[model samples]
Structures are given as C-alpha cells and as structure tokens.
Target chain A: MRTRHPFTLLTLAAALPTLAWLLPAPAGALGTAAVAFGLAAAAGVRRVLVPAVVTAAPFWLFLFVLHDLPTTLAIGLRITTMVAGFVWLAAVLAPDRLVEAMVARGWSVTVAYVFAATLSAVPLFRARARRIVEAQRCRGLSPRGSVAKRLRALRALALPLLLSALHEVDERALALETRGLRSGARRTPLAPPPDPALERAARWALLLVCIAALVGRLV
Target chain B: MNPLTLEGVEFHYPATEAPALRDVSLAVAAGEIVALVGKVGAGASTLLLVAADLAPRITGGRLTGTVRRRARSGIVLPTPWTQLSGMAFTVWDEVAFGPANLGWPGREIARHVERALERLEIAALAERDPATLSGGEVQRVILAGILAMDPDVVLLDEPTAELDPAGARALWRLVRVLAGEGKAIVVATSDLDAVPAVADRVAWLEQGAVRAMGAPDLLAEEATCEAGLGTTVAGVWRAAGLAAPYPLTVADAIQRWR
Candidate 1:
C-alpha cells in the first residue's frame, strides 16, 4: 500500500475526509472514521494511529462541552475523520515518492521540489535541533537555567543551526542545478514508484464516489 | 583544457570583516590529484569552495577572478552528516540521489549506484539505513553519493575527517583511481602523511591565501616545516636534525637512516 501511487493514496486520504463532511452526521461520520482508521492500521502506520486518536480525543471533549451529546458525536466524528485521514497519509507517504510521482506525471519540477523539500525540512531541522541541544549541553550552556539563561541558550543553539540550514538552501540549490533540475526540464524518475493502471482507476473512482455520495446526501 | 582552473581568485563572505581567500591560483588537469594542506583556518576549505564554485555562486560571497570549469563537477563537503539527502532511507538510495536527480533512466541509475558502492567498497552496506551508519561508513557513503554523479572534476573538503585510518587509506586510493580514470580531483585535507603518496601536487594555504604550490615533495621543504605544514615523517626527521633533505614518508626516513 505504501508503494502504491502517491496520488492514489492522497485521493483515498482526501476522499475519506470529504465524505465525512458531506454525509449526514453520526452514522455516516462514524462509517468514514472507521474506514480511515482501518486503512491506517492496515498500512502499518502505527506511529501515527495513537497520535491521531489522541489529537481527536481533545476535540471530542471540547465539542461535548459546547454542545449536546448527539451533536457532539456528529461534529466530533467529522473532525476525527479529517484529522486521522491526514495523519495516516503523513505516516505512509514518503515525500521523495510524492515528488517523483508528481514529476513523472508531467507536473513542474519546482512545484514537486517545493512540496518535497518542505515535507523533508521538518525532520532535517528536528535532527539538527537535537544535535545543537547536545552540543550546547557539552559546552556547559545549560538550557535548564532561569528563563533568561534558557533563552540565551536557545539563541546560541538556534543561531548556528539557522545559519547552517539557511546556508544549505544555497547549497541545495546548487546541488539541484548540477542534477539537471533546471526549471521546466522533465526529470526522468530513476524509480518513479509504480503507478499501476489499477491505481489510476482507483483514484478516479474515489473522486467520483465522493461526488456521488455528496449528491446523495444533498438531494 | 584544464578540467578545473582558478586564477587570481579572491573571495569575501558577505558581512565578514576579512576575505576568506585571496590570490589563489591553481589548475587541475584530468588525471591529476591536487591536494590543499593547511591548518583549520588556513583557507583550504575556502579555496575548495571557490574551486567548486560554491563560494561566490551558492555561498553568497564576492569572488573576483577567473574560474574555468571545463566539465561538470561534484563536491563532497567535510561534514558527511550534513550532506546527506535526508529523504533517502537506504544507502543505495542515498548514493543514487544525485543520478536520480540528474534524470538518468532507472536502469542507468541502478548501474551507477551499484558501481559507486563497489568502488567505495560499501556494496555490503547498500541495504543499511543511512541514519544507522557509523562515522566512517557515513563518510564512504557520502563519497559514493558524489562519485555516482560521474562528474569530470571532483572537489572534496576534508574528505577523510571522520574516517578511520583504513577508511582514509581506501579513500586516498579511490582518489588516485578517480584521477587515473581522467577525473581531475581537488581535496582539502588535514592528513599530511597521505599527501605524498596520493597527491600529484600540493598547495599550501595560509590565512586565506595560497602561500605556495608545488610537487608533493614540497612537504619535505624546511619552509613547510616552519609553517607547520610538513608531513609527519618530515617534521619528525627535521626535529631530529637528521639531514638537510627531510624525508616525507617513513620509507624515505628509513632510506635516509641507511
């Protein structure tokens, strides 16, 4: 499933949330949420499942506080469907495959690059942040001191990482240039994750099913 | 044509009080390995960045001089940890990143990636997660990544900084093999002992300037010793007052003793 087309996975992820919103509450919302969670479990994105449920749990509590029980269940399930669907997508979707899929399908390389780079920058920054914290601790600049001292430690930790990572933007640009990622050039995907014909059919089917259900609910 | 050339090149990083490199002129033809030796702040890295076109082009610095690159180039910066393509999960994929980005066909990408793995003697590591690699393994992986790009000129900044002695020896041999294959190679390194055996020429940089450029035997020069740029054997021989011509390697020192 992880190896499936990125757009196909995206379609399923997006459809689950849309259907939950379009359909009548409680029963319909619960159904979509169930399917999304099931998909998440099946995909083995165990890292995200607990967080997705925990994240939705707060919303349920808030909704119940502001509304009656039935209404709370209705709105809360819709929100849960929206949240869990995306969380699962984030867990399963590798950014590189997304970029490759986008470029392989004739999308602009710059757009794919921006999306992939942004997705990847998070983990890269997080890893660097950890290193900086460790290095600062070794240097005896305690981050556990008073607020002002902690703030200074943060500044010390942040400045080098920000400068280094910012400098990487330029280096990455040059790296991209050398790789023939010149604007508008169609980069051949060394291994564009297999987007089988069935997956394309499934993707379109997902979109149409969402539209049909939306009409069914409205009418 | 020189595979890589820099003539009268000077560079100053933006907002800096002083230039990082000045009056650095050098040429590297295909089949030649040029090494830059100096202390931590000796402008060796700066000169490499200039040669790799990172100083002025990507680094936001002022460069005044001629830089002629006759072919495509790849740079392997010092920190292998920072240079990784964060998206790659496996070592194979990491090495393939450059060729994949270059839009090579899938089969061709695989070919290049595998060959690079073999060359770097990391074929067994192709399946390992890059995040789990040791410092030396990471260094080799980074070199493999750059080499898979098939560049005509390779610029390496402190390429062996994190390697074990054996790994460093392998890397130096790889450099020679690359040069034999007609790729011009420029390396900025602190490993003076390996310079005599690996480098065809050496440029001594000091305080952001190329102070001297000559054959690898320049390591035996009294001037190099005075500047703290002498190879280990040469420095030790000079300290012992062995002879006027200091030996740059252990073998040479033995011959001198005989």
Candidate 2:
C-alpha cells in the first residue's frame, strides 16, 4: 500500500471522505470511518491512529455541545473519516513522489512546487519553533509561571517565529526560482512513481462510486 | 570569452536608498575561480547574486549595468536548509532536483546526479533524508545539487560557513575541481586561508565596491590585512611585525621560514 502510486493513494484518501459525505449517514459514515481508521492504523497505531483520533475527538465534543446526539453522530463520523483519510495520506505519501507524479503528468512546475512546499512547511516550521524556544530560554526568557507570564513568553516566542518564517518564505521563493522551478517550465520526473493500469482503473472506479452515491443521495 | 561578465553594475534592493552593490565590474572565464573576500556588509553576497542574474529578477531589486551571461548559471546560497528544494525525500532526489527542472532526460539526470554525489563523497548518503543530515552534510548536498545542473557558471555564497575544518577543506578542493571542469566560479567567502589555494583571483569588496582585485597574493597585502580581511597566516605575520610581504598560507609561511 505504501508503495502504491501517489495518485492511487490520493484517490483512496479522497474517495473515502467523499463516499462518507455523500452516502447515508450513521451506517454509511461508520463504514467509511472504519476503513479510513484501518488505513491509518496500517501506518502506525501510535503515530497515525492515535493522532487522528486525538485530533478528531475535539470536534465530537464540540458537536455534542452544539447539537443533539443523532446529529452529532451523523456529522462526527463523517468528520472522522475525513480526518483519518488525511492522516493516512500524509503518512503513506512521499511528497517527492507526488511532485514527480505531478511533473510527469505535465502539470506546471510552479504548481507542483507549491504543493510540495506546502506539505514540507509544517515540520520545517516546527523545527524552527523548537530552536526559537531554546534560544529564548538561553536568553533567560522564562516560559513558565502564571497565565500572564506564560502568555507573555508565548508572545515573545510567536513573534520571532512568525517574522522569521515570513523572511524564509522570500528566501525559499528565491531558492526555488534559482533551481529553475519557474512557472510554465517543464520538468523531467527523475523517479515518477509507477502508475499501473489496475491502479488507474481503481481510481476511476472510486470516482464513479462517489458520483453514484451522490446521485443516489440526491434522488 | 568569459562565461559571466558584469561591467559597471549597480544594484539596489527595493525601498532601500543605499545600493547593495556599487559600480562592480568583473568577468569570470571558463576554468577560473574568483574569490570575493570582504568584511560583513561588504556586498560579496550581492555580487554573487548579481552574477547569477538573481539580484533584480528574483530579489525584486533595481539594477543598472551591462550584465551578460553566455551560459547557464546556478547558485548555492549561504544557508543550506533554506536552499533545499523542499521537494526531495532523499539526498539523491535532492541532488537531481535541478537537472530534472532543466528537463533533461532521465538517464542524463541520473548520470549527473550520481557524478555529483560521488564528487561530494556522499554516495553512501544518497538514500538518507536531507532534513536529517548535519549542517556540513546538507551543505555538501546543496553544492552537489547545483553541480548536478552542470551550469557553466557557479556562484557560491559562504559555502563553507557551516562546514568543519576538514569538510571546509574538502569543499575548497571541490571548488577547484569545478573550476577545472571549465566552469566559471564566483564565491563569496570569509575563509581567506582557503582562498589562496582555491581562487585564481581575489576581489576585495569594501562597502559594495571592488576596492582591489588581483592575484591570490592580494590577500597578503597590508591594506587587506588592516581591514581584518586577510588570511590567517598573513594576519599573524603582520601582528608579529614581519617583513613587507606577508605569506598568505601556512605552507607559504613555512617556505619563507625555511
């Protein structure tokens, strides 16, 4: 599954949530949620499953607070399916493979680059945030104590992180440009993931299933 | 003919009154390495940016002068992490990123990428995640990435700043190797000691201007030493109140001593 083409993985991730939303709620959503969670589980229970559940759990609480039980159950399972599918995709998909696939498919170099950069930005910023925190601590900026002090510390940390991230955006743009990632430029895929005929058929089937489900729901 | 030439070039970043580079004129021919040495804010990096044709184009700056590049060019920016393509999972792909962007055939890309990896002595690290590498490793990876593009003109800004002494020496050797391949190389660096061995010519930049340009021995002169831009051996000799001509490297000092 992990070795599947990026488009195949993307289709599965997309189709799961689409089916959950279009199909009848409760039973339909529950089935999709189970499948999505199962896929996420394959990546790792501790890393992917635990985080997906932990992330989606808050929406359930919020739904329960705002709406009745049945409504909450209906929306909650659909949201869970979406979140789990996304979690699974993020874990199983290699960004470079996706980029290569896109470039091989004749997509604009700029579009492919933007997608890859957006995917890579999270961990990049997280690492920078950690460094900023360490630097602040070394400078005797305590991040502990009462609410006010912690908030003040948070402010100090957030400002530099935000500013530096903005500066990095410009630097990254220049770097990408120099690497020849210009708009309309064609790129050769060095290692485009192999997309089999069976996988392509499966993707089409998934798309058709979603369309069929949506039609059934509307009618 | 020189692959890169900048005659009477001046550049200003948007919204800045002080020009980042001022009336800079230089030409770099094939199989030659030119080193730019200066104090901080001395416009060496800006000179490199201009040489790569990235100053006014990508940097949103205004420029005026005759800047001509007869061949393709690539630049290795100062910070390795920031310069990453962010689209590569492995070091191999990271190095191949530039060549692929040039729309080269798969076999060609592989050949260049492999050669770059071998040249940088990172064949063993070809499969590792670039983000996991150390500063020096990433630095090498970045240089390899640019080298794989096989540009005729290579511009490097502080390429060895992150490297340990041994790694820095290896990079200087790589720069010389690149120059030997008929690539016109321009590097902005503070590693004056290495400059003597690697650079064919040295340009001493002072406040966005080329104050002096001459042979690598120019780094041994009193004016360069006075500005604290001289090589370590030269500075030491000057500090010791030695003779007029200061040796630029330890080897040069040893030869003098003998």
Which candidate comes out best when scored by TM-score?
2
Q: What is the interface RMSD of candidate 2, in Å?
A: 1.1
Candidate 2 off by > 4 Å: A37-69, A134-152, B255-258
**Alpha-carbon RMSD, each predicted model:** 3.2, 2.6
lDDT of 2 by residue, A29-106 (tens): 999999999998889999899999999999999999999999999999999999999998989988777888898899
Clash pairs for candidate 1: none
Candidate 2 docking class: medium
Give the per-residue lDDT of model 2 (tens digit) for B168-237.
9888988888888799999999888888889999999999999999999999999999999889999999
lDDT of 1 by residue, A54-109 (tens): 88899988898999999898899999999889988988888778877787888876
Give residue B83's error in model 1 in angstroms: 1.3
Best by lDDT: 2
Show what share of the native A-B interface contacts model 1 retains: 0.35
